[model samples]
Target: MGVYSEGFLEAVDAALADFEVEIRQLGAAASDAQILAAIERVVLALNSVSQGVAGGVIDTDEREQLCLFIDEVMTENGIEVGELAARHGVSRYAITDRWRRW
Candidate 1:
């Protein structure tokens, strides 16, 4: 049984795709403040996804994919998984377990 429908995952993917484009556009020419703002957006997005998973709005497979996405985003932004886990009130082990599967 799945907690999230296929339509939900597709919507998430579409939103992520838009985010990626926005990040790219905030490239070298973007100011330090702009970069920080962009990072904040990513953080908010990850937090939203984490909250959804924690609240049982996302299924196991969706959680796995979201975790992978979170890992990638953290790596790219030089953020620590432990830091994110702490912020989200989730166990680092849980995050890492899904991240490893990615």
Candidate 2:
């Protein structure tokens, strides 16, 4: 068992799936604009999930999994997280920190 419920995990998976779709929809020549938009949406979705789960409060374990999830999704879509963070002047682990209220 994990720190999150099955429903919570499902929501996270759906968010990631939608993110992949959004990126692929822009085709192989995905604009940086497209990438950034999709990133924002997914991060928002994760934030919503957290809110729905427990008043937007993410525990330590849930936060770890959520961060890992974003990193993997970005890498899978050929989005270099290092460069993404560099552009925002944040750490790679902080990629999802912008919209992550929890």
Per-candidate TM equals: 0.42, 0.74
* Top model number, lDDT: 2
lDDT of 1: 0.53
Question: Candidate 2 at residue 79, lDDT?
Answer: 74
RMSD of every prediction: 7.9, 2.8
Tens-place lDDT digits, model 1, residues 1-102? 455556545556665665566656654455545544554565455445545543235446765665566456544654465665666576654644422321
List residue ranges in candidate 2 displaced over 4 A.
Answer: 1-3, 53-57
Model 2, span 1-102: residue lDDT tens: 246677787887898788877766754467666666777898898888878864235667777877787677667767777886788788899876777776
Task: Indicate the worst ten consecutive residues by lDDT in candidate 2.
Answer: 53-62
lDDT of each: 0.53, 0.74
Local distance difference test, candidate 2: 0.74
